[model samples]
Target: MPKSKRNKQVTLSKTTKKGRGHKELIINGIRDAAEKYSSIYVFNFQNMRNSKLKEFREQLQSSSKFFLGSNKVMQVAIGRSSSDEIKPNLHKVSKLLRGDAGMIFTNLSKEEVERLFNEFEGYDFARTGSIATEKVELKEGPLEQFTHDMEPFLRRQGMPVRLNKGVVELVSDFVVCEEGKPLSPEASRILRLMGNMMATFRLNLVCRWGSEDDFELYIDGPGDSDVE
Candidate 1:
């Protein structure tokens, strides 16, 4: 073989070795993460500056239950696992690969997770990016009916609206939703409140373990008799 050909082969070998080492490290990290956490939420962000990303990282760090990992490494780690439970949900995570991703690991029940998501939904982080998911069209459907019913509810919440250029806009100077555009902060706040209320009402438990009967003896009977 020529000298240049030998050097090229050596470089490729080094790259492959590095890739395998990183994959192994990520696999170990995934195993550790799975052992420590029962729920993981993967999120994607876009167009955010390094400062804003750092801010988000700091916020997640305060929670002490979140883990963010490199996509390639994580995928390798996940592939080595035999567990099918977490694997199925991993499909929803492909969207994260398209942009910046942060994974949240929590011991919270699914209802709690949904609540947290709803709470943060209204938070506008400098319009970093659009939800890469399919756009939720506001056609005639449950959402439409809810939006109609919510007009009064919004007004009650101090977000009155007015028709402007064939679109609804908040009347309050503090709350403005321009036509053919995304929601403003105040508008988003009201929407978040509504979403949280709906989510709370429709809370579904995704995964649950342990026995409720373990605490039964701590309570008194219906007749006020001690049931120790």
Candidate 2:
């Protein structure tokens, strides 16, 4: 019986936790991006289009970074609710991560961010629940765009249409959608039938936070007022 060497116990860092590697990556990325960019914006997006967002990211690769993920993970990444901020005063950004939001880290000025958002929006067909931009109505007449064979399909979409003289014709004046109502499936179909698109992709920079200053609210939209 000689001497037995004592075993060394090791503790795992937060980054090494199982199934949480992505969370750790988010935290590290936030810290690194904060150090590199002079401005950080909290943004809310309508209609998530992955491909378009990818292109947008590519356009800003030279000087900006976009971080979109679970709000809780992002809250943790920025050292929210604690003095252990990754970067000075930047942790306050986590408070704005409440709903349908993401983060933009950039060295671009406020004007530049506004310009980028204004010039770089994608438009698409409105989906169910999207508010109609204008009143959509199908007048009582032949629809020259559609052929007679599409009558049954159009009828199934709640349209009062029939194949008359080898063309789809509305039997009556059917109001597909109103200006302020949530679009129904039938309304969405009618919009496509008429070759109309109602969804306009947009981004609102609700708040901005810097490493040295507190949150500044952007009041271009409703309910964005900062509490005194």
Candidate 3:
């Protein structure tokens, strides 16, 4: 070979940097929503599920806009102090933006927001490392739920399974998961195969601020002077 081009130089150019402009966009979006809507609520989530959230968003797209991302950026959008806040008393809501939380800018009444948040809950499969809510055991008998071809897969997932008479059977009683224990990767897979759902996704409101007088909803949230 005459000239080798194995290590050819490749220059990559783009209009926007990784995180620089995105942060500005988020700040602008929150600030804009603050003016577009009458109230702002800080809500925290447990076991967040993006698909479920997407569905909720669609349902509220007509009256509300949700923002979830960097808490720092969101705090900045609403202002961390009274002096710089885009709207009056919004800084108080900003203080409650810590942890797995997001903001909802909506024109709906306060009662409506509270009722919807209280009622919405999504159940999904528990992932690895999530605590098991209940015990799941497979009896030592034919596993009619699984096909014969799934024998190897079941075995690889730590199930004591065998193919007997063209049926999948467990050689011994197997405890797939135990209550109050962190689920292993194998245990999570087995639970999904058995159609067990353990994770619950829900949103709890922290505080609200906007055109109306600011008030706190959840006192257990992190913040200063009952604001967080």
TM-score of each: 0.36, 0.83, 0.90
TM-score quality measure for candidate 3: 0.90
Question: All candidates: CA RMSD in angstroms?
Answer: 16.3, 10.4, 2.7
- Pull out the clashing pairs in model 1: none
Candidate 2 lDDT by residue in tens digits, 1-228 = 966557655666556444578778888898788888888998888877777788898998898999987888888887775476676665557767767888999888888888998788877888989999999777899988888888898889888898877878898998989999999988898798777989877777777876565568774454334322
lDDT of 1: 0.43
> Could you give candidate 1's per-residue lDDT for residues 6-79 as a string of tens digits?
44633334333457676676668665775676555555543435554455446655443544467766655444
CA lDDT, every prediction? 0.43, 0.80, 0.88
Best by lDDT: 3
Clashes of 1: 0
User: What's the lDDT for residue 34 in model 1?
Assistant: 59
Predicted structure with the largest TM-score when compared to the true one = 3
Error of 1 at 185 (Å): 26
| Candidate 3: residue 29 lDDT (0-100) | 90
Model 3: lowest-lDDT 10 consecutive positions: 219-228
Error of 2 at 120 (Å): 3.1
Candidate 2 TM-score, C-alpha based: 0.83
